[model samples]
Target: FGDGSFTGKGLYHVDAFEAALKNRIDENTILSHDLLEGALSRAALVTDVELVEDYPTRYSVDASRHHRWARGDWQLLGYIFDPRGVPALSRWKMVDNLRRSVTPIFWVLACVAGWTLLPFTQAAQWQALMILSLFMAPTFDIVNGILPKSGDQTPRGHFSALARDTVFGTALVALKVLLMAHLAWMMGDAIIRTIYRLFVSRQNLLEWRTASQAAKGGNDLGAYYGMMYGAVIIGVVGLAIPVLADSTGAFVAFFFAIFWI
Candidate 1:
């Protein structure tokens, strides 16, 4: 709304809309897709809205933008459940919004839980299997994309292509997962703090600022590369863990590896 990314386009009555903004909506709410869409949906104005091609053109810029949007979604989640005078949104709509709102939280928790559980499981086979699965999980889509369609290519050609795809895809996936985990951790921490300030401590939302503009200037890139390097270090340590002949050494290494996750 501030950047002309969204416009009313004369779709609703001007006076009613202005009154809603002044009285119903929280002025301090972060300008976000969820806030706008949720408010409109709750008001039963589901039609005549259009999404424009206003996305950032660069990957770095897009990532930075999404970082903020992720926080905004978390903020919206509080609004969804608050006792404040939000309109009666449909149950299905609320559930959908809640899922979208908490995606980063869920991802962060899943990664942390996966890492936390790794050390406790007694079965060595299961541990190895889980590691292998993480490595292989991101390759399925690439393999599918590169596979030759029926009657389209030679079997040998498909096999060669698949081998190449697997190699590249696995590396890319590993990098992406590690970076995403780091970003999720950063975002999740911010969201948690914001929740604590806004709801748990009963602070005024208008006075709260979870992240300052200066802090965000380079965190997106920094977190990505920092996590990637950390993953590499952890992977090296994990590879060396199996070489330790003693069960106690292996056990400690196992916990260390899990802690890395």
Candidate 2:
């Protein structure tokens, strides 16, 4: 697709070559990952050459853009279980994509569980364990995306590395807490839609939907509020679990949910 137009995030970073080298691709998929997988299977020489990409600005545009991407990445799952010529690194990347789809769901569950279960459950240790599992899954992904090689640069001691990852991870998440809930909803929707497609309607897996904003702006405030209504409602509902039933253990979760609102 980058026979060159400033495409979205991943496409701009695609590994491309002329027609002769392009013939290495097995499937005619739109995703750069798919294309890269096909090329890598055929032993193509690869290198990193950064290029400028046009990041989507409008929220609707950005969401629609990533929705297409989520579909594309999910489509790679078939290769994961039945490895056919895909390299080890590429295969693991497919597994990582699966984790990405589920990570948001884990985040939502963590917030809900921390707010509700952690406060009232007598099995305090178990509840905290579950909450930590759900909470840290998204944090690991966040930190991984921000610094893929972070593990290598950590101090030599094992405990020290973990402590640093947690401290830095919490601070970083707090900075983007506002967007975290939105991302959780968006990626959760992607996971649900992907599941439905896998079972019910296998067609249109490759369909690409671009965000359209052809109409000129007038009172975008109404449109803006209309879009955010769901988020506001979710924040209010999620907060209720901790706000009304506040406890010592739930305070951490409550504090996070305030920014989430």
Candidate 3:
């Protein structure tokens, strides 16, 4: 009973794991924990496995690791859907696995889109709902952090870290979503082609890439903070403009400006 780092002998019993790898056709394709988990689930071996908490102490390393994981997940989408390689799982299981893999991308998109559209729509119901949802999300995370048996111990700098993560993490995710969306819009074909080569064409998928330069060694710290602070300002101004000036156009313009940053 263990997480993806399971090095014990029990893993050898999961025939689907080896089958998935062999079916890949390309021997050099990089393997990921998600792929193994999906394979195990598809083969009905999930119940036999156990998971444990493994948290990273360094934020920079964790960010880099997550970036690699996201890329691996995107790449796995191609293999899972391809008829040639991955062993066929039940339709329901396959769909569920795919959904789980892309959950993060969907979440970021939803947050960005919701915030961007909120001003223009001026829907009070939606505004209330968004506020409640955002508040609940972070509150839940904070509660989870302090809960007994949770992976993350209460940090020594608990309040500061919690506040920083809540604000910076939201800003960072918004920026990432906007960047990815812009790239997709501007270089849709090129991006698609690259994915095809890496996954479908059996090109090597083991390259390491940094997710954000700003996250590395506090490089360009000023610029990063400037952007984050700017986002906060824009969000505040966007909401305030509508109430104070009673101008929908002003509210929308400021809201849209947030994405431009």
Model 1 lDDT, full chain set: 0.50
Estimate, for each residue in 1-261, the C-alpha lDDT of model 1 and write its tens digit. Answer: 212112323255557666655655665655454445445432333366675655454444554455555555555665566625544543334446446545544653443334434443443444444446555545666657674677777889888877877877778655554454444455555567557755787454433233333234444756645534544454444435443432333553455345445
Off by over 4 Å in 3: 1-25, 37-54, 83-128, 131-196, 199-204, 209-216, 219-261
Clashing pairs in 3: none
Residue 214 C-alpha lDDT in model 2: 18
What TM-score against the true fold does each predicted structure earn?
Answer: 0.47, 0.58, 0.45
Candidate 1 weakest lDDT stretch, 10 residues = 1-10
Give the Cα error of residue 192 in candidate 3, in Å: 5.8
- Model 1: residues with Cα > 4 Å off, grouped in runs: 1-13, 19-22, 33-54, 57-59, 82-175, 200-261
Pull out the clashing pairs in model 1: none
Tens-place lDDT digits, model 3, residues 67-146 = 45544545555556664534455333445644644544444344444444555465434434544554555566766755
Please state the error at residue 225 of candidate 1 in Å.
4.9
What residue pairs clash in candidate 2, if any at all?
none
CA lDDT, every model vs. true structure: 0.50, 0.57, 0.48
Residue 166, candidate 2: C-alpha displacement in angstroms: 16
